[model samples]
Target chain A: MAIHPLRFFDVNCGIGPYYNPPPGHDPSVSALLRGMDELGIAESAVYHFQAQQYDYRVGNETLLRETAEHDRLHPALMVGPGHTGEAHSPDEVAALMRSGGARILKMFFGVQPFVPGPDPFLMAPLLDRVAERRPLLILDHADIHGVRFDWIVDILEGWPGVKVILVLPKLEYHERYFYALWERFDGFFLELAGDQTMGTLEAIVARFGPERVVYGSRYPYFTPLQTMLQVIYSEIDDEAKRKIAGGNVRSLMEDVIL
Target chain B: MNTDSGILRSALAGEPLDDVLVIDVHVHWGRWLTMNLPAAEDGIVRKMRRAGVSKACVNGILNPDVAEGNDQVASAAKRYPDEIIGFAALNPYQPRPMIDELRRCVEELGMRGLKVHQMVSAPAYSPFPIDPLDAAWTQVWEYLDARNMPVLWHGVVEEAVIARFSGIPFVMAHGLSSPATFRALARYPNFHIETASTQNTRWYMAEAVDVLGVDRVLWGTDAPLDDFAHRWGVILDSDLSEDEQRMALGGNAARLLAL
Candidate 1:
């Protein structure tokens, strides 16, 4: 499958390649490249669906290896400190980053974040490791699936260098939590597709400045067309649209590109 | 064993609740919140064992989320023989078809009654308002009264719900907006209150023994529910005696539904 050179980095797409094992959707470089072509996406950082509900390290490692096997795919190895028993110790995570298995780490907020024991600030070593290795860390933003804004601010204050990506925040969450984090953090970025109303993106751009937001549609359960429609039909300016539609993610990905 | 029979153990909260054959009356029997539905043996066994529940009325969510719960509840009851009873929920708007379906759950599947949730996911016009004794909602009351099965309706309105269900046996849910509804539902002989999901509406369940008589209340927990079922356990641990406790737990529900 030929690649779409226009898409910078795709986010929120399902790793349906693992479960549905398509005639063309096998977990190979060809399958990912094909996915990008079908969706007109440039490079997508997808999460293994199996890992979303289960283990993270092995699934993440295998995904990274599969991406390595493919010359075209740029993989974001997802991680959650709460789900995986081993990675709670940031030292173990630091080792993984040093070894290059850890790219951009994904954290789930509703289930894994806000669990009592682990302090959100304790991830300094882990985020620092990703930053030290120049890898960006993406955090889910919403009361439903990610960390609270207070935690996001804590992360930004603690690890300013690590590019913080907010993933798939719900509508209410975007309005209340996103604004607070934007006010506090200098480099916090919003991942779109979760916010699909006409002026939602433009409103955020107006408030937080354009550089702080990017576009990533949660696909499969949600479709590429639906996500694409939101960005295409949005009232945000073409420059801001282009930045979110592709450019912002591209800038963030440049830091983590292997 | 004498001590056990007379004094039931309870988690801290309310007075020692009723202690008849403690039935959940409301339980989710099928697996699968999204996409796929598992058999839910774990859910059934774990919930029953956790609260020391002897019987449960089950529901499913396959058909608009709660459709299959009826069958799952009944089958679970069959497996344990009187340990679980299924109560099928009927969408009131679809009242015509419900005649046959209600017959199946009660006559064929042996479900105890109908458990309809107005707040959770029931569609609009399902119940065709059994209006407050006016000539308008006569058809709705006729259809419900015809079935003669106890309708476990999850209702929430002040004097309105009680007025609408004047002659029917309705289980006011969540204490129906606290003590006010709890006090009102008591006026009707057929209406009862199930303290299942009411976590802490003090006006609703604190001194429920004094508010709603022991016989007017039932101990039902939304099973496989998080520890919220502890609300009933709190009732069990309440200061009430074993006999007074039995009526609230199962005796009252069993008699009301004729189980």
Candidate 2:
């Protein structure tokens, strides 16, 4: 069997010390790259687990330094509202992106102890800065139920310039909230990590176009091969497949102007 | 291994599978979440076929109507003896009744093991806190312990309780969601882990294999609730050795169920 060339961009992945990973799972850059090599993922945008779980400084720094060696690895700096100084203001965050050359921003406001904004009023200054830079801000939907997506929607509504990508979306909620959001806002994107419902990939592509979807393995936590195979073997056309596999994420990366 | 990509494509397309014997340890019949199925057994068979599953152990979680559900599972297993494996979905509230029912299920109805979802089945059956260590479950536990039957447990029962009933093989259904399950596996030889649900990520499956060895980590789908391809793919594509993959997929369950 002749294997095809690589053309995949994973938009949602993590590195550094994950708080709770599978037993004997190594969350190192080399391990991640090795897996990516096997799965044929040409590039990936990743954040560190420590940024979401503990401190962003350690995680963001580690993500930059570790991923710097590998051209295929693109660092997605973890940031939150500097309410208690765990994260930074929008200007400070943009500065980190400028210095670190980070093309993406990963947030875990729902999972971590950071306020992602019920009061968009308080967090306006930071969000305003984020809006101007227009980095692909990836947020984790902690669970199927009671994720402050409504709060997130308000934030998006307030600042349309901030391109938001949701990771780990549930099937039920995809129809309820996310599909409509993706439909209305061109800035909205969905990572394929949590899109596990059968026939959903085809359905999403058919309705929303493949451009709205990004290939995300959610590696170290998820098997990259599964989603990689999913996109490769989907019933969708080759052009649509190409867009989902790498084109969409590549475009997102190119659009990130620091 | 060179034909891995072609083999996966065949498996996904519902074509005749390769030599790999894929057995799904956790599957459910009847309704779950907000959706109701017209024919639960038929739906599962279709899913199993499409996902290239050789055999599947099913739990009909028709709670509050436990008897009806168990009967459905038992009959389904009988109807498709080679393909379907039955597990008695025991209701702890009906302890006395369940003991006789379980005996009947195993001896006459062909149920090989027990399936109990403490979170889903408990609160409706009994009142608050609904402890697994309650005296109400004593007779049933003793009965299972005597039989040396394996149970697919879906709740956070204490390691001490699992240690106490060392005779019965307890397989924790969802490896990721349960931290106590990992602890139990470490402490007790009888305790094992099943790879199921979205919580059973590739890393977790690899971890389960690392902690308990491939022989103790069983591949489960929690099917109908979860897709078989998505769940099983994690095991198929995991970094486990081919021998380890074989054991996790079916070998472990085959030995546990005497299938």
Candidate 3:
């Protein structure tokens, strides 16, 4: 096949699959990088399992070390409030970000002992702390096991700089949220991941200018071929299409590169 | 254009078109609604501008508007006529009102179609044959069949229900609960399915279209904050052909909506 220049560059892809148990070794940094190469993705803002589901310190540390080791991958450090069941001490959460390992501190509030929005649980306060630093907070906002979109938007609004990486937008509400983002916040981005709807991405690009969206393949979860094909053919202007495929994320990496 | 045949609209089969509009056939605004309530028109219009959605087919809602939500959808459709296609959110329980609104959708508001949910309309509306053979739905489909419009349905167990409604066109809402249903709809002309808001993986649905025809299935992204590229990416990423990709992107909906 003739080479397509856009396919050669993707800046920020999550490190997992479209399926729950994503494909990869337990925090295998190599598997993540290889997946990137195969998909023609030049780089990514990586999040580790330890960062997502398992214990925080070990997971965050593993992520830090792995990210430090990879050239093509960046990191989105996961955080937990101390009072929550999966609480990561503020100091620990700070260390991961302060150490300059993550650009956007990823938050999975649904798993918290404290209810998602408010309660004695530490989610609200912890988020306030992160907001202080003005870091983007990438949320796992799908109907998955139980992630709520309303709570996600509330948190995003609460913390002004918190740029939400609404992963799996195709699985979310295109009509509603597309309108909300442009009206509500100008900075946050709607990201596409897994092998979701890259075709819809093109459609969105045609309607909305291709600025607030990015290309995010939930890596390891989907093979490179699967993720790559999604962006291969688009209906938007070819230049804008490439941006949604990779450029938007490439620029976002200026921040995600943390 | 389908240069090989030159029978249908060049743009219809899988060719270039005049507009770059988008239509999301499957999506929902219900459940755990804790976020800031977006100003339906301004919010969606702004986002559409940002996400690149030219128009979206929004359907299904709850509580306050069980019977009236379709009106709100119609409002959005009217306000953003180019950007939104409001699907009537019918309550099988409130079948009379649901049908009333469905008629209004076609006659007054000019909506393209209807959307249903067993989980939402269930036992409350009337549940037995799941297929709209019930006095209410039979009439509803009968009316729809005469018009030849499509219905986007979500079932407690959607496939069997979809099978019962074979002659009428259907768009499966979720992939998880609707898998077996998709396999069945793969064959019929009056049915189409999308993987945007379904509870299953986009990869699986992409693979399913093959056993099913690529033309029979379409692509949609539940947007606002959801990724359009990601959903389309799955279809394009699949083994499906470019012609197939064109169909999924907007071709299928274009044809289905045309009728």
Best candidate (score: TM-score): 2
For each candidate in turn, the TM-score is 0.46, 0.78, 0.56
DockQ of each: 0.01, 0.18, 0.13
Q: Is candidate 1 or candidate 3 better by DockQ?
A: 3
* Model 1 local distance difference test score: 0.55
Cα deviation at A167, candidate 3, in Å, is: 8.4
In model 3, the Cα lDDT at residue B169 comes to 70
Error of 2 at B116 (Å): 1.0
Task: Name the weakest run of 10 consecutive residues (lDDT summed) in model 3 chain B.
Answer: B1-10
Q: Write the per-residue lDDT of candidate 1 for residues A51-103, one digit (tens) a residue.
A: 55455666666666666655445555556553347443566666655565446
DockQ, ranked from best to worst: 2, 3, 1
Instruction: Give the CAPRI rating of model 3.
Output: incorrect
The residue-level lDDT of candidate 1 at A86 comes to: 46
User: How much does each candidate deviate from the true structure in C-alpha RMSD?
Assistant: 21.1, 4.8, 8.7
In terms of lDDT, the poorest run of 10 residues in model 2 chain A is: A110-119
lDDT of predicted model 3: 0.56
